[model samples]
Target: MKATPITLLVCALGGEGGGVLTEWLVEAARLAGFPAQATSIPGVAQRTGATTYYIELFPVLQSQLCGRQPVFSLSPVPGALDALVSSELLETARQIGNGMTSPERTRVLTSSARLLTTQERMQMSDGRRDPAELLKLVRAFSREHQVFDMNAVARECGTVVSAVLLGAIAGSGLFPIERRFYEEAVRGGVPHEKANASAQASLRGFAKAFEIVSQRQTQADFVSQVLKAQAMDSRLRGNDAGADGNDGRATALSVIPAEAGIHGFPPPVREFASLGYVRLADYQGRSYADLYTRRLRQVLDAETAADPQAANGHAITRETARWLALWMAFDDIVRVADLKSRASRHDRVLREVKAGEDDLVKVFDHFKPGVPEFAALLPSSLAQKLVAWDRRRIAAGKEPWAMPLKIGTHTAAGMLALRTLAAMKALRPRGSRFAFEQKMIERWLDGVVQGTKRGWALGHEVAHCGRLIKGYGATNERGKDNLLHVLDHLAVLPETEAATHAIAEARAAALADDAGQALDATLVRHGAPKREPKPQPIRFMRRPVPRESMDERRA
Candidate 1:
């Protein structure tokens, strides 16, 4: 009779040493006198690509003496894999999606860490795929899966993640191999390292993963206890209390320093709201922060009355606090200049571009100024003049004026330009742009207050609409249109009906697509007319007038 070969497929980022891990496993098997083979398919780094290593081990004695050989696959075949080890949470899910994992057969070991994808880091709005959703799929697909911060363990061990992964496989008891096989593989098989330290990292990773699996025997009760402990710890640190600061309706929230003008709210909510205050204050000034406070208080009042637990807790108010801050701190030309001129920004550019302390780095920011950016910096009547000038330029088939600034953050003139715009924060509210943003925010908050009066779920949906109002210029305006669509079309439910379902659906649809196509579809389903995309301004280049066909021109 033939013996079955054990197969393992490992997925890792490029530098994470997935190939080294595969070599360790094959060496472990060979040292045990078993016939083993390892192969890998390497890819570019990050979300662009992943490296996968496959290992197959056959029976020891039979392969040596009985002339029995096993044929193993060079690449993983979906549903046939016995084990999968991934260095990232999303990569683990990616293999599962490719059908490499089966609930009946595969055991998964993966890191519960995320390195955001390019799509998630987009500037216009929140482009992140939900981590919770990825986790849910991980738990559902694998027969058994273990997750932990393997990268931290690797760092602590003074070795790479490859050593730890080898240890995890060794400790898993998936094979009858001793821990020494992994140790021997690291010390003897791997070159260019102190054998002791490499083996130790491998041992620690193995032990840790094994301990986690052992705990999973009582996983449900264990998870419940951990969650409760975390909740308790949070309460002790950031206590969530009622508006009266008596009833514990919430846990302590992250607090900001007192000097950041993060006043007008209790410390718990103040800390949560401070980032927005700093942002808007820097974008405009302290009075703009005052406007933020007044709008936030409106939400708090509505929340205090409608929140079932508010008499004993402040969760809703705190949740709404950050969004109020963000909405009020809308982006504009002034913000861009202020950020670009910061010393920290200059330092970051140097560090990222890898310029040595003595090395000089030059940065030029490209800007195309149309009516809006220029007009916003001018007073009302003068702004109208700039707008008229831009209209004439576009009408004359000329492009908007542009400026390329070599970053002079360290120089007086360069610093002055950014500082001047930063100082312009004081005049922001008087500008046409700030007024438009503030008006949109006011109208949105009105819906949220009304939603809270309706129900908690509805309020939450309304609060979530904050996700749509982000970025600047056209991106900001599109999000506002989507918010209005839901507020006007989808959320006009009768007081008795549950508006939460429709509103939540609309919010999800708005976030699902950049162009708001999904949002349009959702609205159309709810009886909205098809929305026309606003026409873009004409550019300088024309279609060459089609060479003025002589016969057609004569006709």
Candidate 2:
């Protein structure tokens, strides 16, 4: 028996069963005849923090202690935790940042899944902190680390994340407690009313997680052996390739698989283009995907001609492939309906709500599409008139038209309504919004090609401006307007280095401010006119006079 207790810490968000997991662990230890203690530090409501559980279990069994009680600490000491487990990636990084982990001692087990923080959600653009950075921190700070998507596993097994986490901890081999004890604790912890079903689901989740972690550990050991053998062979041959050789091998393994419909493009461009092709094909049809490939080829050809040596690795074409595909698959009423009507979406809802096989669950979806949404599906001529009419009504202080719908998707009528709307994909090509989007896409593509012919950097910056075209409704319109403003004033013919920097700056500014104020300031600073604002009609309103004041005046 070891002299000291095994120190462990658990970090989990609300509703993920952090407290329950701690209870199971403590119970498992006690069942194993080990003296165990646990304490918790609760976090604030919402995402302000994650509740943390600290545990200590005496390494020696009570039978071996010979009437002596092993003392346990109420909380973890920094650099002393034998294991650190977390349910969220960012929270794992956060705990590491607080000096609780040690490269020489801590073994980290974390979920790769993300629950975006308030700061990330509040950003005007994609504000996600790169998961790669968080993973890197975990690797650098921990003696060993294992990461996989626990949320996905939990959903697949029809259980909460706690079960999967418990499985991982057991499979990690950090403690002397056996797997059966953990299983026993799990079964013991369930309520008698729904014990059979809930226990089966949790046990399934636990077993799945255990299998995955055990397999990963085996694979890591095998890989280490092979890499060592190869290194030894190289050393015997007097060739010490070291880190560079390993890196090259890793890069080779990471090569992107060729996607269909982009076989004609060069490998680098084909990587992104293939993904775009598949996306557009799913969004519209094979013919639409074919169009995407052809357009991508235009940029690729121009970039290849300009930078024959492949200095930038065909970056402009790759960027265009990604952004063009996303732009073409713009969100509209039809797209929304298509997504909502998918079988996978319904399945996801069922899993999220934790419905059992015998349980009957009803799903309801609500929508309130206004005038502009309806106008998007009409012919260009009619759509324009409808939009103008709605604008005038708004200008006259009248509420614009809207249709509010409550769809019980579990019902046949509701499902039919959504599917019928989704079936309107064929009409998208003929719609006003489609025509307008295609025209803008062509213009943007032209700028990319023209800019590439002039300079590589300028073309890359122009392609990046596509980031502005996102979301729907006013946000979408604002993005398009911002992109056009940059293209018109900044995408000068015979592009200069200064113009390239200006375009980059303008793109950054556009993403930084949703209202386009920062973008306009950037353009003006770069010697261009600010984007012109659309005129809004002013309306006068009469304020209501208080009844007592009116009576006093009358007296």
Candidate 3:
């Protein structure tokens, strides 16, 4: 039988136990009496940004033939790898880009998308591809490809997904090692009983799945033998040529062209010039090569400028931009700084944005005027409370503002407007408040109408105004029982409902504190929900039977 090297490319995130998986494969090969090497490139968030482990194993004649050296370089030839295993979908896609697998020879086992790069989650132009869609594409490329929700399976097995994924790969039957080698490898450093059980489960699961593809080895062996024969024949031909006579070698030599008839240059130079080459010295330091390089650069630049995906160097589309923008807007409205920080926290997000993570739409939403306008009308006491709340958020790795809370920016302007409106409302008489409200609304409407032409919208502008009004009204009545609870639910209501709730909360608080019964007259005029009577606690009594006992004893 001809010997064939089995190469396995194990792809995963940096912290996803890729090293443990590599170790398991190495130990399994050793136990099976195969020569094996395992090498890894630890991802550093710069190049590819995902850890990749490579393993190669071949049958060895004896234990003495095995060496300690690890295979650190990738195989150069195509159709050489036997298996590709990935802990994440994007990592598998990366291996495809590197030409590590072919439809005929390689088997792929990958987990569906459980771990997503920050870019995939928030910044990619085309947005994240569905894990199922990616798996379908891989399956189309190779019939041996398989995908599973390893994360779900891990949860079911009460272990991590990485181990589950590795188990599945081992179960594929591409390797020569028994399941015990993999089990023992996983058991290292873990409690003996638990490790043994987990390893056993992994081995069983892999063995069950491995039987499906075991029949293809006959074809692989045939191909291996053909390649070995060709290699041997080539070596024999080289030896035969080396043993030939001088005359036999001399007859193979070709004539060189004379310079005199070749434009005062060597025949090779003349031929190259005719084909398009130019002599830099004769051409005044300019040549076709220089011109070609410049033109190539220009084409690249133009292509990058025209194609947004090219500019980003990955698939990012206009639809993705719109989705990210909306998500940013949602984060702003909800005051969810954690989501914003996490949205672009990784290199993937930076790569997808091209301009850096800070430039991503989700991160950009915080800096917009609409977000801070609502933030500004919040009472100083409430603002202080929120600031404390935000400090905790920042400590928990959140970005507190949709944008930085610096003064003199558009965000500040919105805040100033909301504060001004709040002050105006507080100073106006209850009866004349509508006139003030109409004036403030006109000012807000004017800003919206002007900003809309500049690509801003009424939804963002009105949300800002509504948030300010609601926060101000809620903070003022926080001492009232059930008022904050009602306001909490009210804040998430439809815009119209929010407005109604804001007006109703303000009216109730005003009536409860009114000294001249003016609020009663106002409530009668406005038709608000009437306050219910407070419930009184019930009292209980006990019987006095002990006094009768004392009287009987005296008798």
lDDT of each: 0.73, 0.89, 0.48
Q: For residues 285-319, what per-residue lDDT tens digits would candidate 3 score against the true structure?
A: 23323432232233223333444343333111111
* Highest lDDT model number: 2
lDDT of 2 at 359: 88
- Report the C-alpha lDDT of model 1 over 1-555, residue by residue, as the tens digit: 237878888888877777777777877787777787888887776577798888887755544657867787788789988889888888888888999988888888888877777867873456667778888887888888788877767655555677767766775666667766767776775552555654655666656655664466357457778878867876887855343455633576754666455466665567666766676666666777767777778877787778745553555556677777777766677777878888889876765554644777767665555577867756677888887888777777787665544555666776787788677776776787666667788888888888888876677678778878777777777888888877886667785254677777777877777777887787777666656777556665545656568568988
Candidate 1 Cα errors over 4 Å, as ranges: 1-5, 13-17, 20-34, 41-49, 58-82, 97-106, 115-128, 140-144, 149-293, 307-319, 337-371, 406-432, 450-461, 481-555
User: Where does candidate 1 have its weakest 10-residue lDDT segment?
Assistant: 240-249
Of the two candidates 1 and 3, the one with more favorable lDDT, higher being better, is 1
- Among all windows of ten consecutive residues in candidate 2, which has the lowest summed lDDT? 243-252
The alpha-carbon root-mean-square deviation between model 3 and the true structure, to one decimal in Å, is 27.4
What is the number of residue pairs that collide in model 2? 0
- Model 2 lDDT per residue over 1-555, tens place: 578889999999999999999998999999899999999999896477999999998888889888999788888898999999999999999999999999999999999999999989988778999999999999999999999999999988989999999999998877799988998888895543556877888888999999988888888889989988988998888886764555435444557767778887777777778788888999999999999988988998889888999888888988898899999999899999999999999988887888877989998899999988888899999999999999989889877889999999998999999999999989999899899999999999999998888888888999998888988887888888888888888888344798899999998888888877888889989889998888876778889999999999999
Model 2 misplacement above 4 A: 189-195, 218-252, 493-495, 537-555
TM-scores, one per candidate:
0.64, 0.92, 0.38
Model 1 TM: 0.64
Report the Cα lDDT for candidate 2. Answer: 0.89
On a 0 to 1 TM-score scale, where does candidate 2 land against the true structure?
A: 0.92
By TM-score, who's the top model here? Answer: 2
